[model samples]
Target: MQWLKVIFAGFIEIIWVTGINTANSWWSWLFVLFVIALSFYLMISACKHLPVGTVYAVFVGIGAVGTVIVDIVFFGESFNIIKISLIILLVIGIMGLKLATEEGDE
Candidate 1:
């Protein structure tokens, strides 16, 4: 479904952030590029069935929060209460956006 595609695209976008950490060679670059392309393609496809503004905002918010968690967990980035609280806020915002969707928008 459209929501599935949107969620997948958003989740995979974490690769855009962490890929740089692993892109020390040409092959890595190619792989990351492929991921980027696929993510965008999925987003575009989902837009056919969902509101672009809602989908984009939710996707970016989820992706940003996901990337931050990925960095902190896997890349040894510093973790703090502020970051945690901000992530909570981001989750709430995403939920609000999703809930705000009109029945006709689905």
Candidate 2:
């Protein structure tokens, strides 16, 4: 459940980051702000129960990997072997962090 919060926060992070790139109007900017707030709120909640360093690392990993995928799929960013390889490495690092820590450990 705590990990879920971190995952959701990471997902929200991706939305806000994309919004930062695409938002052009006042309302869109406001929406981005809202999403940012929600993402941080979720992160803070997760931090209360999990190791902050691990939680933050995983959260950022998700956001970074997801953002790149978003760019490739939606924004037509060029895909390359190096980008994909790095993404895979990042995913492995995230999983390793998850495995290294036990739930409820501070």
Candidate 3:
């Protein structure tokens, strides 16, 4: 359950990142700020049940990969071999971290 919450937090983080990047008006900025706070709150809540190290890495990794994919799809960013390889490596790392993290290892 906490793992799911952490992943949802990452989704919210992507919203904040993209919103801030493209925000041109005060209202949009406010929305981005709300999302930022919400994301942090969710991540912190999840960390209480899971190891901070594992949760933090998973949260950050999701945000990183998600943001990159969003940039490519919506921000007109181009994808290349290097970017693909790096994303794959990051996913593998995140998976490894999840596998290695034991309950109450915090």
Candidate 4:
């Protein structure tokens, strides 16, 4: 379904972003570029079914939060209260947007 496509796109976005962190050499950068291109394609496909604004907002928001979590767990990045609070706000915003879009569809 459309939601499945959106979820898949989000997953692809995560892969692309994670690739950026692992890229240390030219070959790795090239791989990252390929993943980025694939992510873009998936995003475009998702937009075909979901509203552009909703899809883009959700995609970027989820990607950012997911990347931050990856950094915290894998790279030993700081996991302070402030950062966690901001992430919570971002989740709230994403949920609000989804609800608004659903209401508008009805």
Number of the top-ranking candidate, with lDDT as the measure: 2
Summarize candidate 2's per-residue lDDT along 12-33 as a digit string, tens digits: 9999999999999999999999
- Model 4 scores worst on lDDT over the 10 consecutive residues at 97-106
Looking at model 2, residue 97 earns an lDDT score of: 94
Candidate 1 lDDT tens digits, 1-106 = 8989999999889887689677998999998999999999999999998999999988898799999999898989999999999999999998999999997998
Query: Per-residue lDDT tens digits of candidate 4, residues 1-106?
Result: 6656666767777877888878899999998898788778877887877788888888888888888998899889998999999999998998888888964442
Which candidate leads the pack in TM-score? 2
Model 2, residue 20: C-alpha shift (Å): 0.2
User: Model 3, range 1-106, lDDT digits (tens) per residue?
Assistant: 8999899999898899899899999999999999999999999999888899989999999999999999999989999999989999999999999999876564
- Name the regions of candidate 4 deviating beyond 4 angstroms: 103-106
- Model 3, 90: alpha-carbon shift in Å? 0.1
Deviation (Å) of 89 in candidate 3: 0.3
Order of candidates by lDDT, top first? 2, 3, 1, 4
Superposed Cα RMSD, model 2: 1.0
- Higher-ranked by lDDT: 1 or 3: 3
lDDT at position 48, candidate 1: 93
Candidate 1: deviation at residue 8, Å?
Answer: 0.3
Task: Please give each candidate's TM-score.
Answer: 0.95, 0.96, 0.95, 0.86
